[model samples]
Target: MPHCLMCTRYNRKCPGPIDAPLLFVDTSSYPSGKKPRAKKPSPPATSFDVARRFEDGRGIHGSGNLSEEMAMVWSVDISPRHVWGDAFFQNLVAFFCAEGRHVLGAVRRTPSWLHALPRMAATPPPSAARNSSVVRANEALGLALRATSAAFSSLETRSTSLLHHAYGLYGDSLRSQGRVLQERGDKGENLYMVMTSIMLSMFESVVATTGEGFASHNIACAKMIDKALEQASTGPAKGRGNNPGAGGPSPMIVNVFFHVRIQLCFVYLTTSDDRIRNDPIMDRVLLEACGWEKRRLPLNMQIITPFARLMKLQSHADYEQLAMPPTEFEHEKADFVKAKEEVDELCADICDSCPRSCYNIAYPPFSTFPKIKLNVFGFFSCQQYCTSARDGQFHHARYVSDLSRAKFVVAALL
Candidate 1:
């Protein structure tokens, strides 16, 4: 009953039948009791990482007309002369427009974490005197952006040159970071400095080594965000709590936290914590600080919290099954199945709701462009979900978000 009641009408399988709950197939016993690594398939351009660009063709197979990628410029928002007055920072802006924006935000579509970076990067120049702290923060942020671009390109394309470049840029960013904290550890430039740490940490998580540290140790930026909120509280003199989220919730701050939530959620999912294992409903101080009191709160409860609960359970179960000998897996297998079912069911109900209930993604009532263009009133069966993206079925962000989360739910169910 929790699944779409009209799935058969749409020529699809029901998402899942409650009577037949999905369970994990333990393959740990194969290959010397060591779980063999599953090779990840490369993501295609249409759905994700939409562009594979080589900024510098040194020691790499050049692509078709990378000139378009390089041509992403914003001549409108801020004066070209100011550009926050940092070259590396300027490149960071271009990188986001060219590749980084499409990579995460366009694919996930869950309130883009990409919104805050360029805006923060594109602020007006600080005074002519140039506050040392602000200057150092800008330089570090720009270097980190350059480093991030190189790191991702190298890993995605297996380019040795980009990898080497990423390493050098990372070191430069790191050296600048020391100066940033030592000068003004608690003052302004908190957001930019924090964003710099996040980009660098991402490079560390994926590029620096294997990616172990990014999960466990990359939480400093989140804490730094909390510090940013603290700094924002004290106004000029009175220092009354001027809530950013109070009036309408500053979009910039809200965007910052939405992005922060992604990292925090990621860390929570990957790292082992006994407390979160018992309780997945975290305080999520960052979201609160970002003022997710209205629709955003509902969105998180419906979307984020449930999925995270499912993932944390899955992560722990994976550790237990993989770490222990395959022979001992059966002892805990039943318990894992029970817990996974509850979480999976919750995510399914929230994300994959009936399309008719939403903005009716067809021609007449909802011709708001990018229609689902459902073929004669197709319905999403609660039991059946297709991972492949249809030509016109995004129906804007909600449908896309729901469909993607459902895939993870189904994957977990299996």
Candidate 2:
């Protein structure tokens, strides 16, 4: 049998000759002795061929194959370096080392966020990595860190782009985490997820654009902390020792505990939302985690505990003034005064025991901003309590003046 057109062109054996004769024929001018040869159809263009043609500056008119190539690019695990390049990564790392770490490090003494930095810096890019989880987490962290660094430096264009990228990675990380949780059924904790959540939460808090979203992230951090604590408490090595840091929580956990507490407090103070402020479980967990029962609280806790108490007092005063009867007002007022005095005494005691310069050496490396803001909020809370005790009948002029002073201090701190 004669070879078919396709096999003849490729020099392969043909099963059989073409079955049908050509439909159009020039019979009058046909060759006398030889049969006409069928024209060979061109082989289908492959992905590589199309890509090469496009790269060579040829116009690709086929949308279907181009669409498929574009889809594959998105579907694959593209690295941050691929999208933003090595220069961007290097600049981001430099920015992170100089400012981003310190900005987040100021939130807690233990430097939990810093724990992942070295690993991330050392790890190969996502395209070369075998573990998807680590890659996703690192991508989220890079985006968040870069976004925060850009925001702090007042780079609007860079910050906006990074913020958008960070949100996209954040969604991917969440979906990846959800799938893991479903498969594992909560048998173990996903530390990478926790770390990414913390970074994203810090990003949200620093950006200050998503107030409610930041609060929700804080809540998620709190839940993660709780689960971690429970795991630690029920570990195989339970009751190993009495010393708090001996067999107690790791530095990361400690930092996370404080970070969650401080953010929640700040959220409540700024927004006055009771959901986080009045969370009894969070309050109890924090107390235990900080080791108040052991009389060995960290320095940050020492400064924050009094403010937390004052916040509680403010919440109580609001409730009493709004809901309680006139007959019960006097007792609530006295309690409020007592709480204010206690906070005053606590501040006085801290100031007396620690020199003014020593105050800056406290845990979380109390920079001027946090130190002054802490005092501003503390004193302002006390002033509000005093005004409330006077049946909301404060001298408007003087109150406004004091508030202006406090606002100025806060502005300077910010």
Candidate 3:
């Protein structure tokens, strides 16, 4: 496979930053089936302005400016030392930039656009060397996916604990208006904000830690929810033995969001292409590492089955305005409870079965856990941006309650 030496960026100023060159070594100038005669190098001036002179045209893919067919070939053409080493790749890029080495031009432009991009010329049977290159490329994909999967598992555990704590505190405030901060709306809105914040942080981390090709914001969100139950095993919250406001924890709300996030992640992963999504080892790893297959809702379609129903219900409730047609809030709440329990059980199984090496919930570490703040800014932000209100007139004033006796449940298992 040939590797693309240059990656074309979408630039408005010049058509491209680099160019592909066309060179011809006449067949008559060399001996047939014998030692070929050396040809003189292209002039330095020709090479010097390669990027500027090359014709800038769309590749066969139409969408990508560069030829998608060159994905494998370009990678192969580039030295592995440069591919694997940051310093080497940086220096190599700089050297290429300085010399203005452009892409080798199309061998011959066939009548059809399909033949415009580069392809392997007819060659003899494959050798050991050819097989080794393929093995290395696949190996790189495996390592990147493996790290991404592991990181997601870690985030799941942390985020789940955060959801549980948020709901637990909300319940306490609801029961006795005087318990915790004297505001119900404030507490509920804050809880929602924290959950959203946790999700954002988890997704941001995925983009940061996973290498370029394999990283995705959605994948990180799914992993955070699927692995949340693991945090429960760490232990219960402290100073709760004598605290009357320490309400019994409810997994209902946490489970709803957790499952929703997980399903979304799986959908994106299923549709992803072979470079990142089509890793041969991913399904096996998911099965053994997380017991995903047994619990998953069949093909990707099954995963969204619940959401399909939810959307329908929301439509009937919000749009139809029909009498006795829409599902009641209690019924919707009950279904959410059922889904939450299932997710909880599945998460527990994953935690129990996961290998010590494969699973690391302690990632992001205790130090990275977000600090809880009770300022008015939290309330305003939640109402203004995080939660949807019935109108600008609607307010979350119920969250403002007394915290004197309310027990502080650590937001997450960490």
lDDT of 1 by residue, 37-133 (tens): 8999976533112112322212234345546756674333332223222432444434433332232112222334544555555462455146866
Model 3 TM: 0.21
Give the per-residue lDDT of model 3 (tens digit) for 330-378. 4555443433343334435545765544333332322422322121111
Runs of candidate 3 with Cα error greater than 4 angstroms are 1-325, 328-334, 339-370, 373-414
Best by lDDT: 2
**What lDDT tens digits, residue by residue, belong to model 2 across residues 1-414?**
223554556565444445534332324466674557899999987654543343234535544454654765633333333333343344443433233224322422333356454465346355536655455555555544444443333343544544444454456556655654555555424455566566666556556665877777777767777776666655754334443344556766666666676666666556556676666655654434533333355554554554454445445433332343455445555555654565555556656765565443232322444434344344434444345445433343433333333323322222
TM-score of each: 0.47, 0.53, 0.21
User: For this target, which candidate reaches the highest TM-score against the unseen true structure?
Assistant: 2
Error of 1 at 273 (Å): 7.2
Each candidate: RMSD: 30.3, 11.3, 27.0
Model 2: clashing residue pairs?
none
Tell me the deviation in Å of residue 278 in model 1.
11
Candidates, ranked, lDDT? 2, 1, 3
